[model samples]
Target: MTVRPPQNLSSLSPNAAVDVLAAEIRMEKAISLERTGEAAAKAVAILNALPLDDPERPRLLAETAEAVWGYFIQRELMGQSSHGAVIRDLAIPREVLVRLGVRRMP
Candidate 1:
């Protein structure tokens, strides 16, 4: 990951800036991955706790859908395009999945 030094290389070593940039990228990716995992966990918890016939179920389902949607988008950003493993691991409901990426379902 060697890069040409910038013109204003006042104090940085040849690779210092590049190294810092790489580390920052890695940290950001790690944070993104962690957030996606947390999002999936939250959606699972909400789905597991919802009552089948409760009046609030619709609202909760929409919330769950949004959370999973964010998780899927984060996964895709990290180059994980397949949802099969995560879907099985989380046991995500098809009802929620159908409404993913849609904030309001008519």
Candidate 2:
């Protein structure tokens, strides 16, 4: 998996975050040739099940952060540069992560 920032993300502007992520994920899907109507529908179903506004959202953030970070670290260990590491390790599509309203770390 090629690592990339939340797609099209130039800044952490909260308003445009979702758009950036979506573009990024879509690009990934295209590059990977994983585009399919069934896959898209399944992704929609899974996303719809997640609670986006719960007060305990931190738990979700923490878990996702760990996973993404681990992916970066693992890729680095495998000889990827920092940029490549990030692109390879991110799990959630950039779009969904931004839709979850995660503020990127400074």
The most accurate candidate by TM-score is: 1
lDDT of 2: 0.48
Clashing pairs in 2: 2-87, 3-87, 3-88, 4-87, 7-24, 21-94, 21-95, 22-95
RMSD in angstroms, candidate 1? 4.4
In candidate 2, position 80 carries an lDDT of 56
Assess every candidate by TM-score. 0.79, 0.33
Provide the clashing-pair count of each candidate structure.
0, 8
Q: What is the lDDT of residue 95 in candidate 2?
A: 45
Model 1 scores worst on lDDT over the 10 consecutive residues at: 2-11
Regions more than 4 Å wrong, model 2: 1-49, 82-106
lDDT per model vs. reference: 0.83, 0.48
Q: After superposition, how far is residue 49 of candidate 1 from its true place, in Å?
A: 2.5
List ranges where model 1 is wrong by over 4 Å. 1-11
